[model samples]
Target: MKKYLHTGILIVILLLSGFLLWRHSVQTRVSHEVVRVADVGAIAWVPFQVGLEKGFFADEGLSISIVSVQTGDESLKALLSNSVDISLAGIIPYSFVALDHPEIQVLALNTFAKDNQIIARKDSGVSRPEDLIGKKIGYSKTTASDIGVEFFLKNHGITKGQVTLIPMKPFAMPVALATGEIDAYSSWEPNIINGKKLLDTRAILFNDVLSTYTWHGSLMANKTYIESHHSSVLAFLRAWKKSAQFTKDNPTEAIAIASAYTKIPAEALKQIWSRYDFVANPSPEEVVSILRTDLLWANLHRANPLATIPDPVTLLANINESKI
Candidate 1:
């Protein structure tokens, strides 16, 4: 009889353990799923950081892991290699690989404005594009900075041979200018802002001169991920949109977040934030127009010799702006 009792107790314990295991599995499934994002670590992605810190992503039942990279190109590479689910990058590098990777889709555009500029030392006597002749100008090769310098020179009737091009990383540009290593630099903020503060430099030209030029800061993802996890994509974008609105509504707090995450001075961010249009969704027409201009520039400079421009309309999926 005691043996029977022992057997019954063992059965009870086993049943209880099985029940608990099933309950735990259900709980795990109900919990938020992790989504990896490759971030370029640009101040333009301040909204994403704000969203993460404020529990916006949590509200969507999603947890985002941001992998920091130095450049947008690096971010794109991470996405292509399956290291991350999404990439935050500029339009140029995004376009370079867009056609090749049909799986990659630009989920949304955060900002569409002129952020690239050509800054010259106040004492360099390069107040105009013509003055850049014979001057040593520094730029990050194959980036918007380089594009700006090339476009600026061409518009002002200056040839590439006229100026000495100094290839340097974006971070080193300001110091190079201050120490007379380069007379001018083609760069974007917050480096531009920080460099100007550290030296007597002024912006001689901005990319806005090209009416067709649009500096697009975009969020992109693979189509497979978007198809399988449509709800998650919508949730991410919703959180991002809310954070962007928060930046506009609460400028002080927004700049604080930006300054802390990017290590950029709040004053500097405040000065440049106005230049960016933090829209969650950009119209297809606008994107196409921007890509058209980018393709033209790429071809003119013969940078991507093997890359043939695709029809701008075919570059992206039929993105439902409603989700964004």
Candidate 2:
């Protein structure tokens, strides 16, 4: 009886030990969820850049692979074609495709601010807003800069016909301005800063022109992806929230990450760092309002416009304010 009792005790202890080991393994297992992201290499995408560099996503049990593109429109295209799981897109491009592509959805707003500006060559006879008339101004069509340039011109009482609007890529705008290919160009940072460097004292920047129009940079994904990978999506947003706080707490480090990722000089990023408000979740109402306004702008500008503008109620469905 003593021998049998001792054997039973030993077996029970062994079983308990094995169960604990299995539970530990289960608790500490690393998730293999890989999220591919497409982003435009710009200062506005600093939160994602910082998060990627700092391994915030890793801490949340996710692996993030990022692809760089030149413009937000390109990033959106990547998202739509299933080339990427998530994309950082501007409100302007999102508005253009929202109705057509019901699968695309806005996960969160990353940054909202007025970052666009008009950079002109002082020698081109553009001393004031009125002087932009009859001058060849380069701008990226179908992006926020296009509408922003229009708004700026309208505010200054200059019609679109008043100035020769030259369509050019953002990266080419600086060189175009430097070589006198275009008298002035309306664009956002890095390009704006580079244009200034090329022209030196001849560069004239109108910073306050786009103040009334707020540009929104958002994280977008396909509705199907969000539905299937709900937990992973939540994890991404949580990592993004952590990164936003990290940026706020350590602006210097965040600027360094942005500089490295964008190849923009740290000094240039620092100059415009305060212009952005990094928020993982922007108000849904505000987003809908902006989309509605941008849709109207797109209808007038896009070659193939939507038959009818999506109502606010319909547009709101595109936004998913998932709390992290």
Candidate 3:
């Protein structure tokens, strides 16, 4: 009787341990959905995918829901409304950030390639940046690319007064430039490649400064989300950094991933992805520079009637310390 009682107690203990472990296991599984802009399109978007495919996210105990966003503004709105966890976008988020949402920060650079450039036809007498004077140039409406293109132009002494700025998608830039409807377009590949294919269409001057500007393809997160899910964020970024590392180490596979995600061919991915530095570091000055230029453009164009970002530094999201 004594032996049987002892065995029963031992069994109960074992069963409880097993059940507790099972419960813990069930509770530990975390799955999250993330959204990015459809136009944030490129190989740079690879880290999110790498985190998914390589079991990196699982290792960090996180699952990401990567989806397409309408644009940068949409991504932030989604973040604000708690629709998604992170936004992979250009510096466009700077346009919306203020004292209201200091938590929205660029966690990592998704990609660093100058996928965008100024494409023009070989003829029609448009060559130097100054040559764009009195010519119709294509740009986007209230976008980071638009702001960047205008800054690039002004820095080169080609003001909007001299160049007619038309709004067009980077993909459609080739068509607009090819059809002679527009003189030139500031865009990125596969449109860059497509634009050049248009029977003598070429880049008069490719703005490599686009890369130099330290503009990032960012992994944006909110403060509330970070505070509640600190572990989740760390796991996500760790997986992300690993994904970034994987992108550097595995070019062929990375190209395939980039091609698959962007739907650009592997050859095109290879050409463009090679040029951009795919690091995870977020540069403060780059963000500041982009914001200052954009704010000026917003002021110059009067893009915002009543909007005022009192402190651009607030956009950087300063916490007591970096939470990596």
Task: Please tell me which predicted candidate would have the highest TM-score against the true structure.
Answer: 2
Q: Write the per-residue lDDT of candidate 3 for residues 1-324, one digit (tens) a residue.
A: 999999999999999999999988767654343322223554446766666678887776665565565345556677777777776666654455432465676555456655656766657577766677788878666555566676678678766777778877666676778778888776544556666666452545455663223344666777666677666666677777788888889888877877777666788667667666676454667667665655455555544444555456655543333455
List, residue by residue over 179-268, the lDDT tens digit for candidate 2. Answer: 899999877766788888889999998887442345788888888888888888988989998998898899999988888877778888
Tell me the lDDT of model 3 at 107: 57
For residue 115, model 3's alpha carbon misses the true position, in angstroms, by: 3.6
- Predictions in order: lDDT: 0.76, 0.81, 0.63
Clashing pairs in 2: none
lDDT per residue for candidate 1 within 55-152, as digits (tens), equals 88887778888798866778888999999998988877776666467568877767764667777876878666678799999987656777767767
Better of 2 and 3 by lDDT: 2
RMSD from true fold, candidate 3: 4.3
Q: How many backbone collisions does model 1 have?
A: 0
lDDT of 3 at 208: 62
TM-score result, candidate 2? 0.88
Give candidate 3 regions above 4 Å deviation.
Answer: 1-23, 30-39, 80-83, 96-111, 123-130, 197-214, 282-308, 318-323
